[model samples]
Each structure stands twice: as structure tokens, then as C-alpha cells.
Target: MTRELTPKGSATRQRIIEGAAAEIREHGVAATTLDDVRTRTGTSKSQLFHYFPGGREELLLAVARYEAGRVLSDQQPQLSRLTSWRAWEEWRDVLIQRYRRQAWDCPLDAVVSQLGRSTPGAQAVLTELLNRWQGEIAAGVRAMQEQGEIDPGLDAGQAAAALLAGIQGGVVIMLSTGRLTHLEAALDVAIQHLRESRDRHPADH
Candidate 1:
């Protein structure tokens, strides 16, 4: 069984994890070591081990989870309140800016790459993130359908899946080419398609 930590102990443990995440971000995961984390967090070997009994791999899993959460958190109120066309546009801008600020080097991608996709916990982290992301997009599509801003006959789930795939593919290209144009284009085109669908089926609205 896992040991329960006092409030102070919990804070310390969180500090260690945050510190380790920063270290990995700066040095890359393959280059970061437990000693580096200990020194950076001002924690001793025992404290580090106490929190991460499974050692580096366990700590890495924790970091992966953290980064995954960060990805969705960064999208914020815009992602959650995508009820109107204006809101969707705002969300699009937010997504573009968020990734642009990363300069094509996504933090979550770094963690997944270092941990390797085949790692036991890594895929779960990715799958959860993608599912939540696609869910939000799907929700936004359904909202527009209900509002009569999109075609009622459209498949919200499939539209969301295609949009999500386009986004990921565009991000991959951005990473490879160091250009945000594809990402921007993908979002604009996807949103435009939904808008055009409404136009195509005016009687359905």
C-alpha cells in the first residue's frame, strides 16, 4: 500500500515533481538524472525515493501525467466554452498561439518521446489526452448543430475526429518544417467546412 503523506510532505513531493519536470524540459529526459532532480529540488536521495519508490521510471510516469494535464489546461475556458462560432474562432486562435509559443517543440511530445510510446503508462497518458481533446471538439460540433449554426445531419463525432487528425498532422508538419501555417490552415479549413455545411443545407437549419 502507498504511504499517506502529511500536507507538508505532499507539498514537498509536488515540489520535487515540478522541479524534475523543469529539469527534464531544460535538459531533455534522456539527459536528466535522479541526482539532477535531487539537487534541483533540494531534496535528498531518501526523499526522492520515498515519493517515487519505483525509481526513475515511476517518476517519469508522474511527469508524463503532469504534461498530459498541462496540454488540456493550457486550452482553458476557450476549449470548454466553444458554444458559438465566435467562441470557436477564439479557441482556434488560442490553440495556434499556444503551439506557436512552444516553437514547435511540444512539452508533452518531449515526455512521450523520452518515455517511448511503448512504455506501459505513456500510451495511457496520450490516449487520455487525445480522447478528452476530441471529446471537447465533438461537444463543440454538437453545440453548433443544436444552435442551427451547423447542419443537423452532420456527424459531430466524425467531424471532430477528422478535425483532431488534421490538427495532429498539421502539428507534425509544423514540427518538421518549423512553420505554423499548416496548423493555422487546418483549423481554418475545418471550421470553414462546418460553416459551409450550414450553408449547403439551409433547409435543415
Candidate 2:
């Protein structure tokens, strides 16, 4: 069973996680080690084990959760408010800019790659992140539908799924090729489809 931590213990654990995450971000997972985290966090072997008794895998899982949270947090209030065409455009720009800046390294991707998707902890973290992101996108689509800004008959869930898939593909390509063309195109085309629906349903507006 996990032991409940005092406030000081909680802070210490968080410090280790943050320091480990930073080490992973800079050195890649294979290059990072417990010793590295220990040095970076100014913690001893006993202290590290105190919080993460399961050892490296457990600590890695913790870092994976942290990085996944960062992915959504980075998108911020923009992602939360995709209610209008203007708002969607702003969200899209934020997505593009955020990924572009992160082109040097994507911490979540690195951690997931290290842990392997089949790992239960990694899969759970990814599933939660994607589901939450898709849910927000669906909510935005529904808002647009309610506003009569798009086809009322359109499936918000399906549209959001496709858009999200396109985005993931575009990011993968961008990461591989060091170019943002695919990402921009995917977002542009997805948004264009919504705008076209709006045009077709102008009478509904």
C-alpha cells in the first residue's frame, strides 16, 4: 500500500519528479538514470526509494503522467474556449506555436516511447490525455452546431476524432521532418471543413 505523505514529503516527491522530468527532457530517457535524478534533486537513494518503492518504472510512470498533464496545460484557456471561428483560429495558432517551440524535444512522446505503449501505465496516461483532449474538441464542435455556425446534423464526436487524428499525424510528421507544413495543412483542412459546413447551412444561422 502507498503511504500518505506529509506536506514536506509531498513537496520532496514533487521536486524529484520535476527534476527527473527535466533530466529526461534534456538527456532523453535512455541517458537519464536514478543517479541523475538523485543528483539533480539533491536527494539520497533512500529518499528516492521512500517515495517510489517500485523503482525506475514507477518513477517513470510518474514522469509520464506529469508530461501528459503538461501537454494539455500548455494549450490552456485557448483550448477551453473554442466556441467561435475566431476562437478556433486562435487555438489552432497556439497548437502550432506550442509544437513548433517543442520541436527540439517533446517530453511526453519521449517518455511514452521509452515506456512502450503496451505498458499499462503508459497506455493509461495516453488514453486519458487523448480522451480529455477529444472531449474538449467535441464540446467545441457542439457549441458551433448550437450556434448554427455549422451543420446541425454533423457528429461532433466523429469530427473531433478525425481532427485529432489528423493533428497527431501532422505532429508525428513534423517531428520526423523538422517542418510544420503537414501540421498546418491538417489544421487548415479540418477547420476549412467546418467553415464549409457553416456556408452550406447559412440559412440555419
Best by lDDT: 2
Candidate 2 Cα deviation (angstroms), residue 38: 1.0
TM-score of 2: 0.94
**Residue by residue across 106-201, what tens digits does model 2's lDDT show?**
789888888898988899999999999999999999998888888988889999999999999999998889888999999999999998997766
* Candidate 1 residue pairs in backbone clash: none
Cα lDDT listed for each candidate: 0.89, 0.91
Candidate 2 lDDT (Cα, 0 to 1): 0.91
Off by over 4 Å in 2: 1-3, 203-205
Q: What C-alpha lDDT, on a 0 to 100 scale, does residue 56 get in candidate 1? A: 93
Candidates in order, TM-scores: namely 0.93, 0.94
Model 1 misplaced regions, further than 4 Å: 1-6, 203-205
Model 2, residue 145: C-alpha shift (Å): 1.3
> Residue 103 CA error for candidate 1 (Å)?
1.1
